[model samples]
Target: MSFAPEELLACALARLIVARPTAHVAVGAASPVPAAACWLAVKRGAPIRLSLLHKRSGNPFTEGSRELFDLTGQGRVDLFFLGGGQIDGQANLNLIGTGEWPGREVRFPGSFGSAFMYMMAGRTILFREEHSPRVLVERVAHVSAPGVSEPGVFRRGHAQALVTGKCVFAFDPARGRFILESVHPGETVESVRAATGFGFDVAAGVGETPAPTEGELALLRGPVRDEMLETYPEFCGRVFGRRAAA
Candidate 1:
């Protein structure tokens, strides 16, 4: 059965989420895809907890980010999703836009608690639908969150993988570089390399990303859609042909 690209990406992310021991997963703002993936995993009986920070209503945290931060600080959050205006080979994230310190040229949304979460969370999964040389830079102009801290620095975790529109890259924190895991359908290694600015190692015998199973598609279009309708109505409508109530 044919599926939307968002559905494919969501299935891929759900696979990643369930691959490891994820007790509590926290998703931040402007992350409909990751949120959908979390719900998909839960619907599949992955036994994962979700803390969606951008939910419009019925939000888990009454005190907002303060409570979320407290959970993360206590290592209760096993996974989190992050993206940036720029992501480099070293996994440094730059939410502060291009140009000098504080991004005087093109200002992105100010980094609020990202550095803290990046350091405190058990692990992170980076997602960016737009995969291009500009978005994946050789070096970020400013470091909003360093992927790997210095020796002895108190860091709970690092990035696990980066999921882009073109491919999936598994981060190797010890080497401070990404390793090509799999390319999305219709994307080739050469094509991904051409679009990427930073250098990365390619996994041996890397293959195309597996298509979503029929069961996975059913869950995404059904239970997952139901769960996300309120929080991401536009996404649900576009990807699952469902709309939220007025």
Candidate 2:
């Protein structure tokens, strides 16, 4: 039984969430993988939380997951999962526009509260559903959220791990830069690099990201699914839609 790319990516992300002891919250859109990871972490007894916004009200997640919004403001959120159209070596993300000529390329789904969350969330885990040079670029046309910036600036919180289809990366806190942390099984650093335009530091010995255990899958399918269905309709739609697609 083989899984599709998005499923594989989601399962890998679930494993990464399990690996981190400090992670208490998993923040991402209603995407399947991120949602699955967050749900799995919760069932694994990691005090997981979700995010949701009202479709008609436009209120900031008034009902779906209050735990996450409260945690962010109180400085309790530790880990968040995100994806973007473009990311830089510094781990900065850009989901704002296509960047053809500032406002020309393509308008994107607004930066889905990334700027607000990134400003306070202590750590983040970034993932890309697809692995391609265009998706993993050297620079971003716009700065949707600053991953790493100078001291005393707006963004100081860190983007801890980036889980891509090809590999995983960890950020160096001192310089606020990214270092290759792990490559998924059957992937190579050279191949991963071919997708990127700029250079990033690779750790001495990059290992393969571990596969998800049965426990992880169970957790994702059980409590997380039930909770979302009970609480968040839009999120449930997005997650179930993507999972069905996969």
| TM-score top scorer | 1
Off by over 4 Å in 1: 242-246
lDDT of 1 by residue, 1-246 (tens): 888888888988998999999999999884689988999899989888788887778888988569999989999999998999999999999998888777889999977778999999999999989999999999998999999999888999999999999999999999999999999999999999999999999999899999999998988888898889898877788778832232
Report the lDDT of model 2 for residue 80: 72
Candidate 2 collision pairs = 133-195
Compute the lDDT of residue 152 as modeled in candidate 2: 73
Which 10-residue window of candidate 1 scores lowest in summed lDDT?
237-246
> Model 2 segments beyond 4 Å from truth?
21-23, 49-71, 100-102, 154-156, 221-246
What TM-score would every model get versus the actual structure?
A: 0.95, 0.77
Q: Judge candidate 1 against the unseen true structure and give its global Cα lDDT, from 0 to 1.
A: 0.90
TM-score of 2: 0.77
